[model samples]
Target chain A: MKYAATDLDHFSESTLHTIPLIEAKHLNLSFGKQQVLENVSLNIHPKEIVTLIGPNGAGKSTLLKILLGLLTPDSGKVVRKRHLNVGFMPQKIQIDPTLPMTVERFLQLGLKIQKRGFFRREYSTTNLEKYVDELNIGYLLKQPIQQVSGGEMQRILLARALLREPDLLVLDEPVQGVDLQGQTELYQYLNQLRHREGYGILMVSHDLHIVMKHTDEVLCLNRHMCCSGHPHSVSQSKEFQDLFGEHTEAIAVYEHHHDEATCDHSHGHNHIHLDETGESKHND
Target chain B: MIEMTQFLVFALLGGIGLALISAPLGVFMVWQRQSYFGATLAHSALLGISLGLLLQTDLTITVIVVSMVIAWGIFTLSHSKQLSSDTLLGILAHSSLALGLVLISLQNSVQIDIMGYLFGDILSITKTDLWLIAFTGVLILLFYWRHWRDLLNITLNPQLAQVEGTAVKTVQLQYILLLAFMIALSMKIVGILLITSLLIIPPAAARRISDTPEKMLLISMLIGLLSVLGGLFASYHFDLPPGASIVLAATAFFAILQLKKAPM
Candidate 1:
């Protein structure tokens, strides 16, 4: 559970060659005078879906922003492979209903508009229509952005991000405001993309169950990382246990050791506990 | 009555340029909800005009220089952590306007036509004014053309824009410079008093009709052009101020569009 610093360093170094997509060394971050992240080192690989999971104010969003190159760390080397196109789906900001914009127009923006110059590159209306169709929101292409549902907007954004065929996708709470069905559908679509394209996905999410089921890896962050590995292992580790507490029945079942005596575990339960003499002990 | 030919020609050129430039930029401003900022910038043009009068320089050059200075000042002041943006904009907008008024008052011998400048005189637009307007129009077109994607990216999401290798500060600089030019040149047609309306109204009207930003901009320009021509005709026929008539025309267009039953 408590891997030594040297062990982590060794693991990081050895894994660097095989699947290194992003590597950060001795990262230190601060907002004004307050230190937010300290002596953090992490590596993310290609085709890996890393979820930054933590409680509120655990610096999950901050670390994600840093990874996206939105914020600069005070002391760190964030080495990314050259020309790595990163597609970002930010947390939904409040959009005014009166403002008029369509899904098709929005998707066209994601294409490399800067390459040809602004307003100079004339977008084919047919091509934009095709891209919006590919997003499965062809029906919503003509609707006002303000009029669309949150789930629909998220899809439109997803379509926009995918238009460029990015190398890496950075999503911050992609399913934050969507309904249950919408969330499921989005994840299914994302999973399909992951399987097909092998693009790296780093998502910051609080939906533990879905993330546990869907993601390839989990990066448990609490200012400092508690663990980063397979979700099943990371969730069962002492750090996760200590942080989330031994509350969930499934996790408790996983954490319980067969060699330990079962007497103390039945403190508040209605079930019986037996001693070595096979005599029942009842608190009531 | 004013000559119809002169009115049509001047209004067409000025109105088209103003509409095209402002509609796109205004959408950006409105999206960012920087209407107050736009108002402040427009108000600061008075100071630029006054500075031009005081320096005995080309009016367009003087206005451009003064507005750019005010814009740079505002940008610099806003960047400081101490002052809030609203407080800064309020102080700068009023202070510049007041300073411009006082300076103009002090220059008694120059015999400046303050009313004409404020209300606009389309008939009075000389060839020099036309040339300046044309040059500014081309500059704005080129500038926006080159940086359109970057501008949209920053407007949509500043943090994401930074991540995507956009030089946000530099883009912002370019945007402000273009805005200054637009405001300075627009003063000849719409006048400083009504310039912000021209910048904002057409876009607002067009947005109600179009679902896409590109279409919105185009529609806004069309609406603006119609208002300018209609206002000019009305002004010539009915003996009214061109600026006031143009603004009223735009407002009427907005009202008519609102009265339509179907949602855009």
Candidate 2:
């Protein structure tokens, strides 16, 4: 279905009214007998970057998979306002060296290829080439998918997804296994795409610090959605504190340390003091 | 000496059709990592051929019916919780091959060229064979034309395809039917033992040089046609077996393409 330009404006209005682009209600997912996601409810707004974060075995990826239609939840209702053309960038895909596909070719596969009545149109290679250029992956277009570096591969996948001009982009750890520079570049490009295209993004990531800075909302999912709202609010929620006790404390300490370093002041002498035997005291 | 015009016509029709059907089907097989599935299906064709011979029926009809049955049966059984696809395919592949061998062996009176059929007998292809191949090719082409998008979607991601309103299971059945048709017809040209090579090798070879799926498929068809024609000609001159020679030609082309500079 063709999406009109006004659709973005309508979507933005809906979000203002607290109507989600996608709403998952009372979702229950189980693999065999073990429950993965239990009564998880999530609402994602349009043109907003929502980050799904949790500890290992926290069903972050499972929730993303269910949303992307990769996994069918055992019981729940997922409501969507529009037919979402979802562009998914899965966690790292291992390309066999024997596979002789290029990045441009990979991207074109996502496009709908149709034969006209009685006459077939000559295949055009330029459309995807232009997309590769737009995604800043021109050099990667000709290279074998197997030979490209992880960051380059991620870019190529992003370009492939973007070529569809999808309404929503779902990324499962898009920056996982990439270096810091690569992660930064990917985030920058994603931000640019969202601003220009107004496509909604739902990203599942373990890198909380990076996501906390760029995302519009944070969904802390541990079996069920523990909290949902602004990153700062979720991070400070009691549920988050209870679920990630020591880890959350460590993050708070690190943030405080970083803030103190940036502000050029000794903020808290009590929390950072010398212990017996000349050892530095730290909160556990 | 072989008639140049007749050989060219044979190569053009047979090669092009084989290539067209295999290219798309092969891409799915590779994507699913189901190369073994093709081999199993090809092996099962021997049972079809054997049944045809025993019943004194038309080879094409017998082979198609038998292959489709086995394919459908395997498809059904694989769906059951009792038997996995790997286990079922292994059982069927070996049993059919063994049964065909035994049944053919029992007939001590008739002198059939078993090796030629096993390897390939491209030179011995009759007018009826050509007609069957051409008609089956059209059917496959029509099928592919109707479900091109659905096929690609399922190949890339089945779950997504299902969610996007495509009948994933129905598409899968159509794929198996198309593959069965291709394998059944290809057996007469490449032989049951070597049919999967024609289905898989050309696509694998073309994958190195082409970028898009369509281009890769076109290149694969061209490669298959060239290999078939070149191998037939080479076998005629060198007194080699046509099937072995064609497979060798394809292998050589694969090696050269791999050694050549990467595609731009």
Model 1 lDDT, residue B49, Cα: 82
Q: What TM-score, over all chains together, does every model reach? A: 0.80, 0.75
Q: What is the C-alpha lDDT profile of model 1 across B159-202, one tens digit per residue? A: 76776667888888878777877787777556875678777788
Alpha carbon lDDT at B58, candidate 2? 86
Cα RMSD for candidate 2? 8.3
Tell me how far the alpha carbon of residue B202 in candidate 1 is from the true structure, in angstroms, after superposition: 1.5
Q: Please list all clashing residue pairs in model 2, or write none if there are none.
A: none
Which digits, one per residue and each the tens of the lDDT, describe model 2 over residues B32-141?
Answer: 67788888878888777777787789877888888888888887787644676888889988998899878777767656676766777665566677777778777777
State in Å the error of residue B14, model 1. Answer: 4.1
Off by over 4 Å in 1: A1-16, A93-99, A112-135, A214-216, A236-284, B1-21, B53-58, B73-87, B101-117, B147-155, B160-170, B188-190, B261-263
User: What lDDT score belongs to each candidate, Candidate 1 first?
Assistant: 0.69, 0.70
Q: Relative to the unseen true structure, what is the C-alpha lDDT of residue A186 in candidate 2, on a scale of 0 to 100? A: 72
